[model samples]
Target chain A: MLKKRIIPCLDIKNGRTVKGVNFIDIRDAGDPIELAKKYMQEGADELVFLDITATIEKRKTLAELVEKIAKEINIPFTVGGGINSIEDVSLIIKAGADKVSINSSAVKRPELISEIASQFGSQCVVVAIDTKFENNDWFVYVNGGKVPTLLKTIDWAIKAETLGAGEILLTSMNNDGTKNGFALDITRKICQAVNIPVIASGGAGKKEHFKDVFTQTIASGALAASIFHFGEIPIPELKNYLKTQNIPVR
Target chain B: MIAIIKYNAGNTKSVENAIRRIGFNSIVTDDISTIVAAKKVIFPGVGEASSAMSYLKKYQLDEVIRSLKQPVLGICLGQQLMCKHSEEGNTDCLGIFNTKVRLFPPKEIVPQMGWNNLQGMKGDLFKGICDEDNVYFVHSYYAELSEETSAACDYILPFSAAMQKNNFYATQFHPEKSASVGEKILKNFLEL
Candidate 1:
């Protein structure tokens, strides 16, 4: 059986891992390479590096950072933010990321998903959807969840899969920083709607929240940022907890 | 020199980086002699079966790959192409392993992506690895089990996780992306 993945997402700004990563036993949590190596040692199933600073110059730095991380760690590395074209995807993948994720660009141009998939296989492209529950329905958001669109979350997910997207990284805006738990309702809805793997993101506060996301929904992976960054939930300990709960986790 | 066979596939750069990280240098090439003369050849690919095979045949690299005498390791599509045939595109492939690749049942997830544990470990490829150890996999098609099967995994149904026949070794999973355990496996293959 395939094990459910536990991913620690890092927000990178100006080529550095932004936000406080409060893990002990390490001096500089802000360094992306150092934190990535540590996380791999701690048994993180995968790592997602979201470059918040998506400028032309910063993308180069992000690629360099990805190269450094790739040289040090062997885990699957996913990079997102500012990927707009086939060239952008090629640049990052050439820099050593296993997958390139597109959110804002994908929303603006749905064909971009198929373009990357056709050029670099579906497994190389990951479409990220930032969704918010609005007016009794889950709606898609663009530009880092600041803009809302009329597109329904379930509808967009199905469309992305048909566009040849291999995986969907679904994030709930309402639960993003709340850390209460995953948006189980929407997560399960998207998972059931698509055959491709859905990675549930946002609203992960405690270890139990991780277990809840896995047990309640069919999410192939759960992604968190602050909990892992602040040392509140070490990946090894979290994996141990999931194992005890009879959850199949790597 | 360690040479990685290049074709119309993705993930070759990542594979090269993986090799470099383990304190070895490698070249990515489709040239027949470079691949044939290398101390070891890592055949890795991530693309449509028919197109990739077409690319291989265009350059006549398929014959060079088959004629190679050094230890060869194939990853994902590399392993599938080593089989006799693949349901992907109803394509025929190099019959080095004497196995066939087929698509997962429609009811099951098309691509059994993410980490999965391995059982029935055998041969030098799994030297320091153990049964039930986790490795990363991302594929919709799988190779049927055969005498060359060194390890097995159950996803939708039992299939070959790793296969070995003489000097030819292949893994359906991406050891390059599987972290420490995967690194160890690659190191084992390099040392072999």
Candidate 2:
């Protein structure tokens, strides 16, 4: 059985890790490389670095950051945020990222997903959808859930897979940073609709929430940020809890 | 020099990076002699088996790989094609290992991805890793567990995680993508 993956998302801005991370146990934690190493040591199953800054110059810096971080640490990492073209996909894959996740760019140019998939393989491309519930409908949002789009969550997900996306990373804006629990209804719905793997993001407050998403919602994986950064929940402890619950976690 | 055999697979660049990180110089090559004279060989690939196998046969790499004396490691699709046959392409493999690869039953889900534990690792590839250690896998078809299986992981059933019969060692999962556990596995193979 496949183990339920526990991922800690790092929000990178201008090529720096968001919070302080004790890397070598000798320095301050604001460095992305240090934080990434610490998380790997702490038993994070995988790491996701979402680069929120979008610009031609920032793209080069993001790739440089990915190359630096990947050299020191040996883990599968996915880098997203402002990724917009086939060249960006090529550069990131060459920069040591295992997967290149596209949000706004993928939505605007659906062919980019197919294009990247054709060149990089579907497994190397991850389609991240940021959604917010408005008037009881899940509308896709871009720019880190700041702008609204006409795409529906489930509808867009099906299209992403058809466009050669290997997996779907769905983040619920209503639940992000709230820690209420997962948006079970939405997560489950997407899981049922797509044949590809769906990683539930947004609200994950505790270990039990991890259990709920894996068991009740049948999500392939659960992702979180605030809890992990604040020490509210440790990655290994949460994985152990899920293992006992018969979640096939490693 | 280490040569990572390239069939135009997606993850070949990462293979080159892993070797570089471990202080090795490697080149991505499909040429026969370049691979034959290399100190160690890495066969890294990710894509449809049918298409990949076609490339190998077309380039005559299928023959060169079988004749190598040094240790060779295959990741994901590279491993599946090392077997006798694969249901993936209605394709036959190089026959380095005795078993045949097949797609997961239709009733069971296809493309079982993410982290999965490898238990009972018996070869040098798993020297430092334990039975409970997990490795990342991303594939829809797997080589059914056989006598050559060195380690096994259960998705719908117990399947091969790592397999070894002789100088040829193969794993269905990507050690390059598996993090610390993956790094250790790669180190073990290098030391082997």
Candidate 3:
């Protein structure tokens, strides 16, 4: 049986980790490499680095930072944000990322999904959809949840799979930073909509939220940021809880 | 030096990075002589079967890879191509393991993506790795269970998660992306 993955997402800006992580025993919360090493030690199944940095020089620094972290961490790593072209994907992957997540750029040019998928396998391409329930319908939002498109969330997910997206990182904009729980209703719907694995992101407050998503929906993974960052929920302990609950976690 | 055989497939960079992370140096190469002379050759790939094999045949890499005596580890598509045949492209493979790769039944989810546990693990390749330890896998087709199977996994059906027949070793999962358990497996392979 395939295990459900627990992922810790690190927000990076100016080539350093922002939103000071409050984990215990971690001396430096700002160093991305240090934070990454700590998360790997804590049994994080995978790591996602959202580069919130600005400028071309900062992007180069981000690559350098990724290379440094890649040397230290051995698990699967994913990088997203500002990745618009094949060169950007190649640079990040060469610097040691296993997969690259695309959002705004992919929505603007849907073929970008297949374009990257052709060069790399679909397994290496992750289409991140930021969605919000609006007007009684789930709408896909781009530009970091600022712009809403007429495309429905479920429709976009099915389209992405057809365009060769291996995985869907479905983040509910309304649930983001809420620390409530994952958007189970929409997540379950998308999981049923596509055959590819769905990674439910945003609104992970407690360990039970992870459980709710995994048991209630067919999501293969759950991604969280502040909960892990603030040491509110240690992954090893969370995995132990999931194990007891009969949820196979890695 | 370790040589990761380069063809049209992707993920060689990740493999190379993993090797480097393990404190070893490796070069991604397609040259027959380079691969033949390397201490350990990794035939890692991720792409459609027919085209990848065609590229290998075009460069005469097929003959060179077959004749090499050094230990060769194939990952994912590399493992599929080492089998006697693949259902993906109806393409005959390198025939190193005598196993036939078949597509998952249509009723099941086609690609068994994400982490899966390995059972019946044996031999040096899996040294220091625990049975039922989860390893990463992403593929639509799998090599059927056979005498060469070193590790077995059951998803849609029981299949060879890892196989070894003499110096030709292969894994249907990506050890490079499988975390510390995977790192240990790679380290053991290098030490072998």
Considering only chain B, what TM-score does candidate 3 achieve? 0.98
The CA lDDT of each predicted structure is 0.90, 0.84, 0.90
CAPRI-style docking class of model 3 based on DockQ: medium
Candidate 3 lDDT, B140-160, residue by residue in tens: 899999999999999979999
Q: Tell me the TM-score of model 1.
A: 0.98
Error of 1 at A155 (Å): 0.2
lDDT of 2: 0.84
lDDT of 1: 0.90
Error of 2 at B13 (Å): 3.4
- Residue B52 miss distance in model 1 (angstroms): 0.7
Cα lDDT tens digits for candidate 2, A51-146: 877668888898889889878767788988888889888888888888888998888889999999888788878899998889889989987777
Model 3 agreement with the true structure over A58-160: per-residue lDDT tens digits: 7888889888877788788899998988888888977878789999999999999999888887888999999999899999999889999999999999999
Cα lDDT tens digits, model 2, B77-146, are 8888888988876987889999989877764435687888888778789888987788889887888889
The top-ranked prediction according to TM-score is 1
Give each prediction's DockQ, rounded to 2 decimals: 0.79, 0.59, 0.66
Better of 2 and 3 by DockQ: 3
lDDT over C-alpha atoms for residue A192 of model 1: 93
Give TM per candidate.
0.98, 0.92, 0.96
